[model samples]
Target: MTKRIVILGGGTGGTLAANRLRRALDAEYEITVVDRDDDHVYQPGLLFVPFGLAQADDLVRSRHRQLHDGIAYLGSGVDRVDTEADRVHLADGGVLDYDVLIIATGARLVPEETDGLTGPGWMTKAFSFYDLEGATALARTLEEFDGGRLVVNVVDMPIKCPVAPLEFCFLADWYFQERGIRDQVRLTYVTPLDGAFTKPVASRTLSGMLQDKGIELVTEFNTGEVDGEAGKLISFDGREVEFDLAVVVPAHGGAECIERSWGLGDALGFVPTDEHTLQSKARDNIFVIGDAAAIPTSKAGSVTHFEGEVLTRNVARFLAGEELDASFDGHTNCFIESGFGKALLIDFNYDTEPLPGHYPSAVGLPLLAESRLNHLGKLMFAWLYWHSLLPGRDLPGVSTAMPRAGKRFETR
Candidate 1:
């Protein structure tokens, strides 16, 4: 009898893991991927959509078509995981029994968690670019805005693409400049973090950029409510920031199914897993990857790609009754758009911070430095995502571990 492997969520992590596992395992294993729908969105493209750089149609594709032919694809929402019974219950009254399970359901934006965020002026005065509809609605909002206090607030931390709020600010500056109303717009970036970003060095660099663009930085702001009718963002500390137009990144949480699955997740619905091994702490036969795992890392697509490499290997080892490799180092790399056809690339792992140098090779694209070449690389990623990343094809010269060969470390 062939062993069964069930993967939840047919997004980036699930699709890549399914394809990679199919290629690695022999005919003795059956791979199945479950998702709620057929739409596989290129999430990074959402940033470009509001700026008219990319379209909604260009960002989505058939999730079922991305998987390998031998892999089974189920278009249904998951109800819960019966870990003790070694089975999964689906919303459509179906049950899938598996010898091994992989959870890659990813994070969800809960706008309703914030008071008045989705009420009154939603899609009119306030908006979010985290989803396709929100991005499209915001595009129209930005187009007609003449000027005034344009505030971008991050409701909480651990949101998907931590750098995206900063990217929006940068692009907004460029957009206003292009329209010859740069001076009319007063841009303010409000975040709960004490700095512009999570990392210190990068935060300082980004903070300086914000100042250069004449954008105000409001840090240590814990949002209490978004009075959309009044166009004010109130923080828990009694501080308030008023806005004529507000772009908010709502609080993110794990899928509801994870919480419904008893003893399968943390308080936030994120699965607790061995950070390095990617195996669930709740059960030995279960694995967690991407944003679904409660790991101290950026919940970005690049992180998912790195996790897939280690996760697929570990899953194969587990099925063969071998010791799993605890080798994942929270490796992540992202291209930060700084607008005006320029961008910055940052590569870092568990112990290393992003440094100024070249990446992959001594002569490769400059790291932690803005350049037009990096912007081009950012655009090229959309092509790579569908053709290489999702297909589980190895990107040339890129490895699972963060490379130190070309990085320049700063002396403390």
Candidate 2:
């Protein structure tokens, strides 16, 4: 009997994992990918939409077209997973039996979790660039406004592409400068964290940039409520930030199906897995990847790309009844877009923080430093994401492991 592999979610991790697994396994293994829809969104493009750099149509493609010919694609919502019986239940009452299962159903933004966020003035005084609709709506809103107190608030942490909120503020500053209303617009960055970013060095560097850009940074703000009608963000500590226009990155949680499936995930619906091996702690036959896994790392596409390399190999080892490679070191790389057509690149892992050096080589793009070259590289990533990354083609010289050769470490 041929072994069956069922993958949930056809986004970056699922798409790449399906394609790579198809190439690695023989023709006997049956591989199938399930997603709620056919739309494969380039999520990073959402950041550019509000600034008029990218459009909603330009960032999306058919999910079916991205997968290999032999791989089966199912367009249906997941109901739950029966790990004991090794079966996946679809929302449409279809059941799929699999020898192996992969969970790649990435994080879901829960705006409803925040009080008064989706209430009155939503899509008008308040918006989020995380979703396509929110981005496009914000574009129109930004065009009509000449000046106001524009605030960008991140409701909670573990949000996708953690640096995107900062990038928005940076771009907003440039956008207003170009519009000749730089003095009129008062920009503020509100976050739940104590700094501009998660890591200390990166936080200091980013906070300085915010100061230079005249964007006020409000830290340790645990948002309790969004009084949209009053245009205020109330914190749990009785503090409040008033805003004329608010762009909020809402609280994010895992997919509903994960919650529906008993013993599959945490309260937030994120799967608990061995951080390095990507194997679900709940079951050995199951694997988790991308934002779906509760890993202490940045939930970015680059992280997904790096995870795919390790995940595919681990899946192969599991099928072969061999020892799994626990080499994934929380490797994450992010291009932080600053104003004036410049960007900064940071590469790090669990053991190392992002330091000043070159990436991939001793003389590559400057690390932890803003440059036009990095901005161009950031733009070039969209092309790479669609063409090479999703197709499971290895990016030359970029390994799953963070290379220390070109990185400069500071001795504390």
Candidate 3:
């Protein structure tokens, strides 16, 4: 009998996992990928939509087309996962039985979770850039406004990219300056964190940059309500921040299927995953990757790519009745777009925070510092993401382990 493998969600984690496993395993194993739709979005490009740096149409492509031949693709929403019997229930009333299950379904934005967020001035004065639709709508709103208070608010933590809101602020400054209205538009950034970032050093450096750019930072603010009609954001602690234009990043939770699938997810709807193994804490045959897993790391594409390598090895080992590789460190790296044709790079893992110096080695790209070369690297990633990453090809010099050779760690 052929051993069946079922993977959920055809996003970055799922696509790469399915393709990687197909290459490693022989014809004996059957791999199937399921998703809600055929559209595979390049999530990073959503940020560029508002500024017309990129088009939303160009960022999306067919999901099944990205998969390797011989793998199956089912285009339908997941109803639930019946893990007790090792079966998956699809929304179209189809059932798939599997020997091993991989959950790569990423987080979903919950704009409705916030009071008055989707009401009143939604898409007119208040908007979001996290999605393609929202980003496209925000583009129009930004183009018309010449003078007013522009507020970039993160409704909660664990957003897609923690640095995106800051990038919006930085870009907005540049946008307004180029339009010759920098002095007229008041810019501010609001977040629940006490600092600009989770990492201390980066946060301080970013906070200084925000000050230099004349953008106000409001920290420790838990938003309770968005009174768009009143053009204000009301915090749970009763603090109100007024705004003429609100670009908000709402709270994110796991897929809706998780809520329907009993005993499959945590209270927050994310799968409880081992930080080092990428295996589900719930079951031996079930594994998780990317934003779907409630791990202590940034939920970015880079994390998913790194996890794919280790996850494929462990899954093969599990099927062979051999020891699994528990060597997946929480390796994460991101390019922070600082606007004005410049960007900053940061690298860190479970044991280390992002530090100053060069990445990979002393000769590589500068870490935690803005440069034009870093911006070019960010622009070049779109090409790499489509051709190399989706096809499960290795990126030369970029490894799963976070290199510590060139980092400047402070004396403790």
Candidate 4:
């Protein structure tokens, strides 16, 4: 008798989970992955795409190729999950039965939620780097503009790569300087959050960086509408931020299929899972990982990477009839690119804000401090992502748990 493991959404989490589980599980357990297509975009690269540092072709690769040899890949859109029957329904009228189900469907951008955002100026003056098409179009737009009000706005929170917006601002500063128009472009950052970031220490650090770069920061502006013809982002309280060019990080939600499945997800279609255990609240035999999990964390690749490691062991333990491990500590880390060839690193878990100090200790890569070496590390990550990260090879020093050293632990 063989066990069936069906993983949905072959993005970062799904792909990595399939590969690692295939290596760990025997021939008696069959692993199958379901996704819409084979196009896997190196999502972080999209930030650079608009600035010409990356290309559409460079960022996308065949998703099926990233999986292990034995893992079965189904490149079709999912329709719904018959959790009661222990099966998944496909959009094209196919079905998949599983002894264990893993939801790694991640998230999708909802641009239409904002009035007039996806209207006339979309992809022309208003754009996003959250996806491949938006990044490609914004790249062309940025290359042609000499100088204007370039406003980067976050429509809401719980979005992917939370630091990416700040990185864009930093890179914009560098981009304009290189083009000899640094003084001409007026850069503004608008977010629904009260500060530059969710983490207190990182927010103070990043907010100061915005000030240093002459990027105006507007906080707590809940967007009401985008008056594209008038070139303004109007907040619900009638506050308006005018912009000649807008790079909007729109609201994000989990896959629609997750929503269609009753009691499987939250209002945003994200799976309500045990934050530590990664077990779906709706079913005992189902687990959720990555962005799809409705966890109070940034939906970033690093988080997905960490979740995969912990989830793999738990899945195996479940099959072996053991107690579930509650070791996943909402662990996540990100590199903050702060332009001028400098970057900062931050590491923390659910209960900790990004602190200043060396990671893994008080003396490794300086955290919350801008360094050129960290910038090099940031650039080198694209290579590491393709060759090391997706392959599930454990880096010697980078542990899944957030480190406590090298942080300025003072109160905000």
Could you tell me every candidate's TM-score relative to the true structure?
0.99, 0.99, 0.99, 0.98
What is candidate 3's lDDT per residue for 1-412, written digit by digit as tens? 7999999999999999999999999999999999999999999999999987889999999999999998999998899999899999999999999999999999999999999999999999899999999999999888999899999999998888888899999999999998999999999999999989988888988999999999999999999999999999999999999999999999999999987898989987899999999999888999998899999999999999999999999999999999889998899989999999999999999999889899889889999999998999899999999998888888999999999889998721
Error of 1 at 241 (Å): 0.2
Clashing pairs in 3: none
User: Candidate 2 clashing pairs?
Assistant: none
lDDT of 2 by residue, 254-294 (tens): 99999999999998999999999999999999999899999
Q: Which stretches of candidate 3 lie over 4 Å from their true place?
A: none
RMSD list, candidates in order: 0.8, 0.8, 0.8, 1.0
Writing each residue's lDDT as its tens digit, candidate 1 over 332-370 gives 899999999999998888888877789987889998889
C-alpha lDDT values of all predictions: 0.94, 0.94, 0.93, 0.91
lDDT of 3 at 23: 99
lDDT of 2: 0.94
lDDT per residue as tens, model 4, 243-348:
9999999999999999999889899999999999899999989999899999888898999998888899999999999999998998888899887889999888
Find the 10 residues in a row with the least total lDDT in model 3: 403-412
